[model samples]
Target: MSRRARVLPGFSLSLGVAVLTLSLVVLLPLSALFFRTAELGWARFTQVVTSGWVAAAVRFTLGASLAAATLDVFIGLLIAWVLGRYTFPFARVLDAVIDLPFALPTAVTGIALSTLYADNGWIGGALADLGFRYPWPAWRGFDHGGWPIAWTVYDRIALAPLGVVLAMCFVGLPFVVRTLQPVIEDLSRDVEESAATLGAGRFRIFRSIVLPELAPALLTGFALALARGLGEYGSVIFISGNLPATEIASQVIVKMIEVNETGNYADATAVAVLLLGASFALLLVINLIQRAAVRRGAPG
Candidate 1:
């Protein structure tokens, strides 16, 4: 009989602890959600998920998340590079500033954004002066100023979605920055110097050499940002104007819960199931694509 070398004692005990923790914290709750959702029946489940409002909320949430994540990648890269590569005044302060969103309460962020974008607020005032209006009309035929005004001011852009995007972007920025900072610091500047010595332009060197290395970390950050944006409720609820079609999926879930307290538990669980599935699917796809890209970039 072969004798096994023991790396550490109490392996069985450790495994038991881990199993217990998983069961109590993650598995149990997720199982409950699944169990509750199962009670809805396939037809009701489909109806809840396939409703037009649900579809619209999903589209809006995903679209906004994608947009925010895309923006985060570039901005995060810049911020990380600045922090990792250069010494500047207030460097530490700037580094700390990047984490403000993490420290801020989401509800506070939402209220602050809403205030800044409301009709009488600073940003809103300037926008209004530039032909935008606040309390934007509810419907098409409200008549802006009587005599059927051709180009109503309030008919212009609304900032609620923009506020949500901004809030999410602020909160999500640090994820990308933190992920990329180490990778960027580890990069060999010698490679870029060699490329430049070989007559490559600045843009060419960055496009060819820098971006590929950064892609994986960037994608990871994008996935994090996208995930956070999808589940975000407090930061989005107040600033999103809480309007149907415009409200996020989380907000919709809250409203559903409020509609019928008795069914709230089951309906809320159902919505959670849907959101969970979507989040899982999106992260899986992004990860797979990133892995494929990384493999393709590797030497054969």
Candidate 2:
């Protein structure tokens, strides 16, 4: 190829710059985190990571992020389809609104979510009422022998861990939405129509034709959202009520910074390493799953 036709000139210089940028922006910070963690030595590091508090935070953080990411894949695909496949009032506005989480400050998002979901707040009050409702009226003949059935919906929902999942869903949704939208928009209707003509149901056509095409994007989006949720702090802190049940790895680190004396972040670093390893393990699992999915879907 002629020099004029080249998209990027001087491959060596471009490669050098890219490597330099990656090292400075990513590697340096990660190295520092690892180095600080090493200062604690093996036994202390193990104790910090294996503590009850850390265990609870790990369980909640991992579980909530995984749930949030899984929910986002479905919800985001639906939203992407709606916005891309149909035209309606405020369509453009809705498209722009999808990026709000990215642009808005985390603190503001937390406060807003917390205010809306507090026990006395609008949505929270409704949930409390909904949860405590009776299944049948007292005047009704059967009425399960006059015993009032408590649904306990709010008890299951309004917990700190559930709140963490909610906050993660809000913050991480954009990743799934943005990742899948373009593919959804570009989807050709021919395969769908052919499947339909062959007597395939709407769900069947979607499953057999459309879903395989979307699987890679869905997995990628899920991975991104999962990573984002794992690292989330500000938005989660408020909405999750900072309780032990909802306490995340980030909160544990922050508390360690304050209570563990100045310049002493051994525990915090240990927690960071735990988080780093968990993120890597999760991502590796996602990658393996993605490859298997692609292979299964591939044509012989």
Candidate 3:
């Protein structure tokens, strides 16, 4: 047999460069974070991470990120379907606009969101007037025996837990939309048509056929969005009101660095280590789910 020619020159050199860049930009920083946390000693690290305020922040951040990512799954699927299946005036423009969150500065997005959702601002004022509120009655019940399970309608969104969720959703939306777009585009309409011809309803076709095809991409998008939302700070801080045990996010660790009192650096780095571990675990779960979905969808 004849020898095959190489596809590209300098493959070794490019690989070396890529590895070096990744190490310098990503690996080194993460390694340093772990090293700093280790310096705190295991007992102290646990003490800091398990502190009441830190625990509260972690709970709130995790909850908000999950809620936002879940919301994005539906919104992103809708937008991707529209863009992939329909043609209309400004369709291209609308598609382009979906990436605005990715391109815009986090601070700018934070400021804009804060402005738009402030109590006196456009949407917030209307909601406030309608007497809307998001009451954690279950939490309240934990503290105070038996609170009524009434749903408070029309709560103001800004500077609340809702604001944190909104910020997360804003920043995470692009991840879901972008990840799912190509998958949606690549999906064939023939399968759907055949199902319809077999007397299947729209919902049945979507549930039995479309959903399986889209599952892996959807999970990947959700993972990416959730990861981003968990680490988000700039936009979240502006709207979250930074109320400890309420709207505070895990990124408050960064603020602790500036203060530096009471061994804040050690505490912050320890919290970071926990966040990193949680993120790794979550991503691993998502990857396993994606792989399972792909396997199930494959022809046996």
The per-model lDDT (C-alpha) reads 0.80, 0.84, 0.84
- lDDT per residue, candidate 1, 175-196, as tens digits? 9898899998899999999999
- Residue 85, model 2: lDDT of 92
Q: In model 1, where do residues sit more than 4 Å from their true spots?
A: 1-11, 132-159
Instruction: Estimate the TM-score of every prediction.
Output: 0.85, 0.88, 0.91
Which candidate number has the best TM-score? Answer: 3
Error of 2 at 115 (Å): 0.8
Give the winner by TM-score: 2 or 3.
3
Badly placed stretches (over 4 Å) of model 2 are 1-4, 132-159, 298-300
lDDT by residue (tens digit), candidate 3, 28-89: 99999999889989899888887767776887788888999999999999999999888899
* Model 2 per-residue lDDT tens digits across residues 1-300: 654666886889999999999999999999999999998899999999988788768866887788899999989999999998999999999999999999999999888888887777788768776774322111212335653332222353344456677889999999999999999999999989988888999998888889989998899899999999999998988887777657889999999989845844878889988999988988898899999989997889
**Positional deviation of 211 in candidate 2, in angstroms?**
1.1
Question: lDDT value for candidate 1?
Answer: 0.80
> What is the lDDT, from 0 to 100, of the residue 22 in candidate 3?
100
lDDT order, best first, reads 3, 2, 1
Scored against the true structure, residue 113 in model 1 reaches a CA lDDT of: 76
- Per-residue error at 242 for model 3, in Å? 1.8
